[model samples]
Target: MITIKDLNKNFGKKEVLKNINLKIEKQDHIALIGYNGSGKTTLIKLILDLLTTKKGKIEINNLNIKDNKFNLKNICYISNENDLPENMRVVTYVDYILKLTLGRENKLTELSELFNFDIYSSTLIRDLSTGMRQKLKICTSLCFEQDLYIFDEITSGLDPVSKTKLINYINTELITKTVIYCSHILEEIVEVCSKAIILNQKQISDVITINDKDKFINQYNQSFDIGDLNHE
Candidate 1:
């Protein structure tokens, strides 16, 4: 579980987040939605300890983020941007990451098979397409077997088929994994997430559980004046 209280952040004199309070329980699949620059990425950074919070507290399973970062290894974060080493092969990269984070060297055959990724284990990261790299990122994160997974704009470059497969894997095989995904795609959010949090004005503007997703989505679209829901 993740608990955030009175969270506040500022860049120089400009505030990015203000007095944010949230509690995320285990097995909760949450979708963090917001326009660009609405503090979605900033909040994720704060949770990952990539940025310092000027005020408030963040705790993961009762361990304070500020004080117990080392103890909180049960978390995996996949950033929006891919930053793999240009010359490292896909398989080697996964192996390295697993060794660093999990202290074991196991082949990610299950993950590769799930994604239908055809890239050779010897192919360098720079040789892979954007979609392939994104698939690799997801595979690596899942292989870590962390309690909490964070995915930021993860489906940006995948085709419809690939995206569907990934979503199905997350919903089925990873049902017990706590996931917090951020995306501009509302349809994807409505389909995969059990809860939705809207970030606005530097704070969480709304928290909604999607019991009747189709109805909730229709109302949300009408309320926000966002023209025809665009899944692609």
Candidate 2:
């Protein structure tokens, strides 16, 4: 559903990514893994057209993103909680997101409940706890119906219980949706994604089909020379 070719990104003279090529097929759940400052977020922003594409090509649903012809209404991106509407009430922000995505507002109730965010419906975003705000972001983003979902560090600040809820939801409800999941939590990646895309040294270093969770985790830990990659 998404294709990138010969992609390169730079800020001033500092190059962030180079020659990044990827293809995400329909209904494919992909884990985008990288160390801090490995340009995972930059790559995602490039895909979302949040950043200008000067070096290469990115296409969504076969339409070139550079052409400004691709409709992102079908894409849902959940990222930084700080980016949420801090001034808006939870319910109001949910309504706005539903409207923006052309999704049913009724779905908000179920999603909010699932994330245990219903009680905060009248609470100002800025007043909520970090975990609550993260749940709010997840609830708002997933309440909509979209073909492609991109989550960047989505589980950050989420409690263990809430994180499990999200994992179960994705494993069950999003089985057929295309997703680009970015996280440092290796176990979560192993559970939610069918394939892993490893970004290292400003480029895609490996793309591995995940067959065994334990085996993949072992390999991943060894590759990065780290004992534990399950934490953000």
| Prediction-by-prediction clash tally | 0, 0
Q: Which candidate is the best by lDDT?
A: 2
lDDT of each: 0.80, 0.85
Any runs in candidate 1 off by more than 4 Å, and if so which?
A: 101-107, 118-120, 222-225, 228-231
Predict model 1's lDDT versus the native: 0.80
* Residue lDDT tens for model 2, 121-224: 68898998888888887877787788999999898899899999999999989999998999988889888999999898999988888888878876776656
Worst 10 residues of 1 by lDDT: 223-232
Residue 185, candidate 2: how far off, in angstroms? 0.4
- Evaluated at residue 32, the lDDT of candidate 2 is 94
Return the TM-score for each candidate structure: 0.90, 0.93
